[model samples]
Target: MDVSQVLRMNGGDRDYSYSNNSFLQRKVISMTKPIIDDALANLYLDMNHPKNLIMADLGCSSGPNTLLVASELIKSIDKIRLKLGSDELPEIQFYLNDLPHNDFNTIFHYVSKFQKNLRNQMLSNSSPTCYVSGVPGSFYNRLFPRKSIHFVYSSYSLMWLSQVPEMVNTNKGNIYMSTTSPPSVIKAYHEQFQNDFFTFLKCRAEEVVSGGCMVLTILGRQSDDPCSKECCYVWDLLATSLNDMVSEGLIEEEKLDSFNIPQYTPSPKVSNEVEKEGSFVIDRLEVSEVNWDASTDHNLNLSGEHEQGYNMGKCMRAVAEPLVLSHFGESVIEEVFKRYTNNIKVSMSKEKTTLVNVTVSMTRKG
Candidate 1:
């Protein structure tokens, strides 16, 4: 099966769903609010007095986070409209986009309720009419009409490559490009990211109007090293768990050798090069360190390493279980994660695990 056919966040509103496990992603969104606000403010300022506004949230997985993005964008645009004392507010059309396999029905189910809430919050007679629709496809390709979108927002996405590189089999006993991966493996991942990211920008450039803005928050590395501990440790631990299973005759070692994660955490410099090669101008770029256990509730008295390991395991499994299930089959999932949780607990007992996130603000240049 292809990557697009399988990659999706854990669906439905169950306890282990993406909706519940996405607190970390939600934190990424919250931390970048100032950047989002500035980009939207500039977009509104540049538009002057448009009658309608079109926006999109790319990689909008199924969850509260999906609607949270739309709601926040709507609220921000409305505030700008009120501040400018515009005689008439523009009608806003929002496109929520993700892979074809995304649980869009879950988002659609909540649309009416979300719209009703938005309606109640409007305080002015000139309030903008909001329309929300889902666009199912890869963001690496064009999904909107030419020169249509005014603003674009994506959070906790884009670190994902379109697919795992064909040459990834060369990297033995690893699911991602790690410190020990051959230079060829590293090169393959980097090349794939450059290709996908450039394609992404090209597609969006055709869709967004001139002077439009995009604010993206993506998992990235802070340093030039692609195999930095912050970028590769999670996958290293996951690989260790898989290896443990292999040792126990639970899963084939060949399966572990064949599988590689279809994701990359690029450095800021790489991002800059891709943007420069595309149709946008970088307005702002910021990298922030986020603790792996950022979502843990310290107040819950979950102080021990075991509890911390459990929390981290749940979070990673929610985001990654779908892909792992597709590659390794469902039978080994529980055992795999069981070992994964223990590995995390042992690691957390030693030192803090922090992941670097990159937030980029850009404008589509004419």
Candidate 2:
């Protein structure tokens, strides 16, 4: 998995595609800070030891979210270090893991900035000398040494698996997301999601130390039903736009038909699978039901086709533009992005309740 190749496929830009707007994602990460603090507090209180604990942020994208999360974790470790009366702080090693196509340079820049800030924070005292590292590979395989990581955190990145289901590709369109489609398409997607999720859990368990705690957060749905229109609105809109392009002969229908984002929604069933893995026991699990008004839509685009009036949209474009352009062509790319913006505006104006259920789960290895 060459880094360049991965970036080429994922639209190259490693920055947050939609981070310009202070949308729910930024808000969610902020609101969840106390949650991480509480979890770390409990881990320090209950775990065998705390002073030298290790922490890693798996699938940390290059943006404010990663930096903020890392800072919080460092603070938690500092607090615990003081309580133990140990001069030695935990060795904070951050694993900025993403697909090969991830912007490692941006992540590296942020890691350096974070380290510099940490250095400044501990000018007078012996602070935990944080070691920053980058892991440019899929989380589906060995990401670190066995039992090496003590505290692992990943946010908003795991729901997208490595690839979508082959069965969905067999269909001319993503019938699973279509408003008028058979129930089986949804069932197939649900099954594929389960498979991908279990694989993710098993892989992480192998890397995490026994008694290690991982705070895993992802974009999920509150409903167990796979056919929930609210949960699939973004996908539906994109698919519809692609169909429009296809009908207009902008791009081949086959190209649109074969494309799919490797995504999955979590449910209690997936939680049960985590428990069954025998490596992780769920310590905490909660879903934040989030909805936002139009005022929060962070639109930063000033142009025609690249314009996405939402911060999240812009950030997403950075991540997806290269691939979209190559696959859909320049003209189609503009049209699709325009349609995406229009769809988002419609969703916002109609007070459409776009369901983005965040599942914050803490698991400890056996």
Candidate 3:
């Protein structure tokens, strides 16, 4: 599918833009903030007191969430400099990276505002010179110079494989790894994930300095089984939505059969295996559950389950619509998400649905 040319979050600041629908991502970033803070502190301890610090946020899609990790990083380092009684803060160079098709302009538009906000928060002398630039490319390949970055961070990314490995004709009416998928389909997905993840680590290893740190938060599976419900149910429901449309003659059945998402939720065991093969020391790897409706605020006393489902549907559409539109015709986008929203509401009414996210903290091997 030429994923790099086609894949991107829904752009601009509309209701369906990734910027508006990225509450779950924001929550994950917030949840991992303390861990990231500690990792940065340790990274500073390990760094040889450099005059400049380079940091990159890989898969940094546009929106308010794009600069979030970078902002927090600068704050963390600033705190460390203050504690050490340093007269000068290191020059901080922030690199935001994503696939070529990502909305870099949206991110660039906010850079000045981000810098101004930072200036307002810190003293003139204490404020480090922060240079922000966009690097548009895939992270699975080399994106930065060797030993150039001090800290690397990615959130709600890495689950997306470079592309869907081998078309699945055997698995009918399903779009992702499901229990109904054949053994070959499962094997293909696992192998693709291993290769992509290994390449990702290798590329970062070359870019990050010795003793530098990396923090990654990826959509993952709680169970070692590749077709675990925690990972596959969402796709299953999405497939169901497509099938419903097919039955209604809105979308062709053949179109549904040929489409599959280029995403894999690896188990922690898989992550450990890949880490061992890469040039990094795994400091911490943990899986946490994030509810589908985690982003919704119940305090507002909104229109109950349907509203929450609609919001969650928007979140999924923000991330998946572009891909779906590329495969299926654009005419079906609204109906697909409408059905998806109903499916989500129905599932939420029955029980809680959550996805497992894996957060890995690592240091470059010396």
Candidate 4:
């Protein structure tokens, strides 16, 4: 697979083959609200000088979802300031980062809208100045001023490596690796995922101020059994379905082997590696086994779900369209998506719909 063609959108999931945007937002808000609240309690941030804190939202996709999370964090900062009895709060430099292809115009517009609300609120003279900028490029590389950030947060982003792992290509069809899975492939990808992830931390360790905190919400599974695809079966299911299409001539075989999705999940090993790097210390590890109410009206779901649905489709096209067209001709993609959509609808027919789960880790590095 020519993985290079797959552009990483901000830092969100790369293999969302069955995504639905609205659904994803609701689910994410429900799941992360508490995590955000807890991070505030754990970090002891004060609003008296909220401006001194520089915070970032990595892989902040376009839409109300990113703003929703940002608003909660802003509120927490405000609450902390009110408690500190400060006449003037410090400015908060907000970095909204994502893949270069993300909807920055819309994000910029949203930030402007948020700013308007802040001004309209008649905030005290001490309210923090919010600085928003778009960091377009790979999170695998440095994304901001060194040692400038005070707190870093990423929701459902870190699980994806900069690109797909090399092992899947080398191992052919016999490999499945993620954060929590069989020890070997999990260990292999862990080694790789950690290497990339630790490099992220190490860079942040340099960029983050002393005593700074970082909170990340990532997808994960509970069992150690590597082959247990329960947590991250979406990709495997899509892959198998694609392979079947190839076998039956529903799609060309050449296109089948040439496509790879850039999505991944993290294991405890990711945290372990961060700690071993000697710059970051784990403060909390919380995993949520969230099950999608497949029965619920899909319209009520969250940004996470849309991402899942889209990657399962939107992103798949963005990444795989060229390969499919080049290998099987452009005329085949429409038919491909139609069948793909049908496959997803059919897969959701059970009484219960479940996903692997998400793991959130709160850490501090000095």
Candidate 5:
């Protein structure tokens, strides 16, 4: 399967759209704001005064978060400019990137409103001319000209491999690596991530200018064990849901065995790929756990887990609906997620599980 085509989140601003269900991503973006501010402050301090700045938000799937992030960068820079009292403002270029199947049209459609709000907010000062363009393609390949970008930020991406591993029957009855998966299956997943991340680093090394910074947030694991409950429980539960459907004859057993999610929850050691490729230096690697449901910030229903589990199901459906449709067809989605919700309730009741998030900050060598 072509991951670029099928790996997109559900688009548009509907109930199940990524736009609505992306509170977790929103929290990730907020958590990285200080890192971004530091990167921008350091960018200005490290280089001679420049008249233009180019930044790229990799895998910038369509949503309000897209503009929220852009605004955050602009606001951070505005603070710097105010502090420095600089009359000469640098022109800013924002390359909003994603795959061909992403909802670029919706993003573009909202740009007018976004621009107007930006202008209104910055009316008191000289704001940089912000140009937003959509670049459609995979970041695993080169997406920008040599030394073209100044700051690069990506979040909740980079876990997806370019393609699924080409092995057969290694992880039967499951869609992703679980505790029950064999060593061979785990080895294949790690090898694929090593290659993909190296390529991503090498490509960015060429595109990002000297002294530039890249602040990335990736989904990862807490334990060295690849199959630990912290790393694989969510997917394992999903696979269990699929298996239940197959037992009920709602889905094909053969299809369940063949499907594999082309994502890996990497350890911080995964950054060794950067040292291996030798283009950038890792500035900082930090790990934090986020609630599986962003709404848990308020209260978690550990007793029955109805609302929380239902929210988790909606979130998963927003991200996984397309992939399931591409491979398993549309017939089983409702039932699969129905069972997935119930399974999440039982599992959450048993254990209050959280997602492991890894944030990495890096800088390109001069």
Candidate 6:
């Protein structure tokens, strides 16, 4: 599949759009605040308090959280400057990047408002202005000039592969890795992730200035086992719904078997790839758990009388609809996710909680 052309969060400002339903993603960003802080502090120290900071947030899906990462990073650096008793904050050039199909227009519309909010948050009156722009391309390919970026940021994005594994055809009856999947299926996912992540590090190594840092948060697993509960269980639960639809003649069985998510849940030990790529060193690696249904509104983005399952269903729809729509077509999407919501409720009843995320802070080797 041409993932760059089709895979995207639900675009536009509908109730089911990623913009409205991405509270969980926002929460992950907030959850890693200290790591961002640490990265910024180290950046200043390692780079000798540089006067200009050039940064990019890869896979910056549109929504409130779109600019939230940029705003928070700017604020963090300002505090770092103040703590170091600097007279002025560094000038910032921030680029927001994602695939061609990402809702760049939505974020473009919000930039002016984001600028206003950012100015209000700064404590220092200095000429260090921040410029924001959108760069549309696959990060899997090179997206920036060599040694130009001072910091690279990504959250909940690296888990997605550049493309579905070519060999996944053998993993019939599952959308992703599962307990029922053969070892060949697991091997295929592992190889794809290794290639993709190594490519990611190699490209960033060329683009980031020596000593610059990347603070990345990706959905991951702690166990080496591919079928670890926290790994692709959420996706497995989603696939269960599609399978049910297939059983009921609502969807074709062959259609469900042919589909595979272009995603991989890597363990923190993927630093092996970083070392092999050999341009960056891991500074801080931490794994944390956030509930699958962590939002304050269990009703999700819906208005009246919704529950946890309904909300999760909406949230997953926001993130996964585009991919599923590209695969199964729009005809059965509603019924599939409706069934997905029920599956989520059942999983929750059995104490299926938490999404495992790995946060790794790394610096380009000088």
Best model number under TM-score: 6
Per-residue lDDT tens digits for candidate 5, residues 222-274, read: 78988888878888888999998888988889888889999988878777877
Over the stretch 257-302, how does candidate 3's per-residue lDDT look in tens digits?
A: 8888899998778557555677988888888888989766444566
Evaluate model 2: give its TM-score.
0.84
Separately for all candidates shown, the number of backbone clashes (residues 3 or more apart, or on different chains) is 0, 13, 0, 36, 0, 0
Which candidate should be chosen as best, given lDDT against the real structure? 6
Candidate 4 lDDT: 0.59
Better of 1 and 4 by lDDT: 1
> How big is the RMSD of model 1?
2.1
- Candidate 4 lands at a TM-score of 0.78
**Would you list the C-alpha lDDT of every candidate in the order shown?**
0.85, 0.63, 0.86, 0.59, 0.84, 0.87
Q: What TM-score does model 3 achieve against the real structure?
A: 0.95
- TM-score for candidate 1, residues paired by index: 0.94
* Residue 237, model 3: Cα distance from true site in angstroms: 1.4
Which digits, one per residue and each the tens of the lDDT, describe model 4 over residues 199-275? 87777777776667777877666666544566556555555666667778776565555454445565555557766
- Candidate 5 residue 233 Cα shift, in angstroms, is 1.1
Per-residue lDDT tens digits for candidate 6, residues 1-366, read: 788888899988998999988878888999999999999999998877788999999999998998999999999999899899887788899999999899999999999999888888777764348999999998888999999999999999999999998783477788999998888888898999999999899899889998999999999989988788888888888888887788899888888888899999989887788889999999999999888777445443645546556667788889889889988898888888888878887887778578888999999999
Runs of candidate 6 with Cα error greater than 4 angstroms are 125-128, 296-304
Model 3 spans > 4 angstroms off? 123-125, 167-169, 297-301, 304-306
Q: How accurate is candidate 2 locally (lDDT)?
A: 0.63
lDDT of 2 by residue, 188-224 (tens): 6677767766787787788777777777777777777
